[model samples]
Target: MTFQNIFFNSQAAVVVFFVLSGFVLSPSFFNKSINVRELAGFYVRRFFRIVPLLAVVTALSFFYVKSAFSTWKVPFANSWFDGVLAHDVPLSASILVKCFVGMNSALVPQNWTIACELLVALILPFLVKACTGRLWLAVLTFIIATALSFIAADGGGKSLPVVYAVDFVVGILTFRILQSHDKRYSDVFFYAAVIGLVGARNMLEVLTGQVDLPFNDPLLSLVEAIFAAVIIYGLATKNHMSRLLSVRWLVWLGDISFGIYLVHFLVIVIVARLMTSFLLPYSLPTQTFLMLIPVLAVSLAAAYFAFRFIEIPFNDLGKSLQRRVRTALSRG
Candidate 1:
């Protein structure tokens, strides 16, 4: 795909994720006291939501990319396999171990964000506490995150992870504003978000010489913060749009979005390989459409099973572990 094509399509879903993250994480921001047990449980749930699909995808990529069975007629060619697993760093044994520990390796390219999400989960409570439900503090947090992101970007590193944390912080701010229940204030933020999003692409293009600025542009952070605040406000208020977003199916998708995000890239790679090998007559768009049906079906099915069996069970286990640790510490 052309750079513009990829930028326009891929970034749309990412922007939605930023908005949804704020909407979902808002509840934690308003609580008077942070519950370590509850926080631990939440993180455990998130971990289970992401890790299983990640492991499967990574394993598949490793086997394919490393040419482990090259003598045999594998489903995909070696070049195809390498393309699927391409990353800045190689997928070596050490990297594979890191992948198991939630660090992304070449085996699953999109998993870089999973690492960031895990880090955000760890510090969310502290961030909420530090902001103290103040708008200025929220703004300050965003500024610091933006500065760090820019520094990282200028240093020739990916700063998307740092930039993404601004979304989480904005999520906390959204919760605070929701709890305040000030209609006028909420309206202002909502409008601001809409305006910012509408102009963000253009602004970033002007500032960074790219249609989509990955992390360097400060305006992109502003856009994220506004987008997050708008989603949070919508979730908190009763409105037509909020009702649409809250529809059972969409909410269900939102619930499983973590799994969807983690698994979708692997699905795409597999589908691409299949199409190439089979000489599928379907055009790219048609193939993409056809591919998504099964991908969504299988991914959602997997997510539902994981949510029911692994995610829920592991969450309870984490809670139990946290309780036991806390009790032991108290006794000591």
Candidate 2:
């Protein structure tokens, strides 16, 4: 595999996540003052949306090290917190507390993103409230955050909260723009985002020897978030740029994306163990290719089950609660 192929990019996708979040939650911010019960219910549903799978994954982590990964000898390159694929995972009390609090990357590792999502979500309503009618406020906030994105922070599993929140802000801005502007301006942002992802990369490569900044810096993360925001705008506006995103298969994949994101690591570990037990003689590439099939299949299946049984019920409950609360308020 090529270096870029082997390289896992958590940054580029993060921007997409934040911008999508802003677009998704944008509608909720439309009401000038969200009712207390509805707001509470919204938070509750959001909690269920992410935390249930995260809890399951965190529980599995303890078992993961001892069972599936015990025989896989390779360790994480940088830190012990990354957790050795073997049974050497750090499972301290504080880390466990952090897991519930949405701050535990040491235990679940990829869950740092979960923490960021939660943080952004919790604060999003406030941003929306403060800036709904005040366009200048939103612009000022985005501008300030954009400047801060350059100041380097950990580009690893646990990124800085503020830096990550920049993407969240971008998403919020995209939503605000789309919501307010009926003109074709949403198309402009969408094209800007597409250019940021595709054209900018090529342009930079032409100028510089090799594309260096995309991999190394959170600065690039800020730029990528613009792409995410615009794409979200396009999709929301029903612009031509986002036509491909509405395809049934792709939309299905997006539905279970969170669960897939949370569970894929464990799935990879299990497949690695199976490969080790039965196919020790196979080369790395052969084993890797074999791992992909089971990993994708298993992750998709697990995500569907999680969505059906755990996510949907709780989400429905939240919606029901909000309706009841609103009805009672209206009657009074």
Candidate 3:
């Protein structure tokens, strides 16, 4: 793969995340005995798990945008990074509401993925039933999602939740389909799939060369989702790659990954601005390295604190509330 292809495909990571979400959450919905109360509890747990940290981070992001300059001219600047942090939307009641829902917020752009996750969570139980219970229904659901995605993209709503529901379904299917395969595959097969997934978009662009065929992007996304599912299977089945990933620090980072995603950009902007004096003389690479040291440190530290204090508490509270509701329902 080329340099840009290799390094610029972070969207691949997001695809993997969506598939992994489907696989992880499938177990609960895959339960044939999942009742209404239990499903409600799933929503409750998800809300607590996702929203508290998101809400806090969103608030911080809003205030940062409110107080900070419209454009921060940092040394060794990345256009993408600078552009993401540059915003001057006057904070009003409507803007706050939009930010809360992850609309029109440059500072917290990644929240759109979280919003999609929540949107898909609502229909996931039905999808589980469709996949597990009826092939025709599953196919129909996929078609609808694909059609909606096309309409959404064509109409300029690029990051709408509609675009990702199909990816989540791919994950659910991966979980269901892989349940039968208890056999191990060669590590070569796993690594090859990983490379393909990571570079899928770049390869597609090179091959297509401005050919805007209808449904092309959606089809490519499906291919990438399948690739991600294969990678997930390799890891879940404890392959060599999975073993390498199981190291203690890596696992801890995975635990706090959500917080890291939410707060890293904000941390980067603040840290970059603070270190501008030291960064002025260095080249881009050297400046990036210098910036990475403290950005990595502060982001990890901040994420850890947020995970420990905000995430765990809200998650536990959700569980506690869910238990109380179940108990009260049982008595009634």
Candidate 4:
């Protein structure tokens, strides 16, 4: 309803990624004809795509964590900012293993999503098999997943992969719908979906009169994923907004978006420290505002480099290995 509301749902944006992941990765499994070798190749590509950058980022975060324990200091009075760097986590093998597996680390807190993604990726092929067997089964799968998510939350296991499994199911169902029916929605409908996506949580709050619902609530996440599905539908069907999104620069940014996600936290911490020393004369608000420019610049530059040197190379290696798998299977 308002301009600020359009940006209020950052958690919904993560849900959008989940839905998009389901959509993008669905085509391979939905044919209902994939063999083990093909599935193996699929797993290989996904593993290579996600893990290499994550490994590098985790290693970098470990260095930052060491520094934070020894020498890092908050320049300002923000509690959340201070808590992330100055903390009581010990340097232990268990924590390091957890970080590698997508548990939260102060340096790369976003890795949990990657862990969820990896889990979904492994089970997705089976999900495709189960959900596509019948129409009612697909709906039942979603219902059960939602129920389980709530159950998980009640048991204080909100971060478990089951909590987000429904989001991926929404995506898989989106693909099924698109495959079965082809309709071109009007521009108004596409724009409406965008509005629904960005304002999902706010709209839910208005409807329920429950402000500040828990962030990982399954019911709220389902609404966000459904809205995301509509937006993905609009784009996949090539609506007017899809044209805007397909601009060359925007496409290039999408290519490096993963890298940006991995490196931005590191940039933020480094810049915050430098800003404390150099811009100490300014108010905290002004320092934060001034910090954005360099953060954006350095993050973009670092992401681009990582994409060029790290991601692309690894992706190609995955593809090459996939080809070999296919070739070997054919011979056997």
Using TM-score as the measure, the top candidate is 4
Cα lDDT for residue 103, model 3? 59
- 1 or 4: which has the higher lDDT? 4
Ranking by lDDT: 4, 3, 2, 1
In candidate 2, position 189 carries an lDDT of 67
How many backbone clashes are present in model 1?
A: 0
lDDT of 3 by residue, 58-114 (tens): 888777777755356675776787676566655678867766765545558786788
lDDT (10s digit) by residue, model 1, range 1-332: 24443344445445556546655665654555666555655566566555665676566566665663323332333576555554333656787887765675466666666676777777776777665556777778767865666565544324556657666666666666666764633555666666555556665577777754553344565565666567557656865566677889888877666666666666655555555644356666676577677777777876676566655665676667666655665565
Q: By lDDT, is 2 or 3 better?
A: 3
CA-only RMSD, every prediction: 4.7, 4.1, 2.8, 2.4
Per-residue error (Å), model 3, residue 22: 0.8
Q: Locate the minimum summed-lDDT window of 10 residues in model 2.
A: 75-84
Query: How would the candidate models be sorted by TM-score, starting from the highest?
Result: 4, 3, 2, 1
Worst 10 residues of 4 by lDDT: 82-91
**C-alpha lDDT score of every prediction, in listed order:** 0.61, 0.67, 0.78, 0.80
- Model 2 TM-score is 0.81
Candidate 3 lDDT at 60 equals 82
The candidate 3 region of ten consecutive residues with least summed lDDT is 210-219
TM-score of each prediction = 0.75, 0.81, 0.90, 0.91
Worst 10 residues of 1 by lDDT: 68-77
**Tens-place lDDT digits, model 4, residues 137-230:** 8889878878877777654433557888888888888888888886778888778877787877778888998877677777788888988888
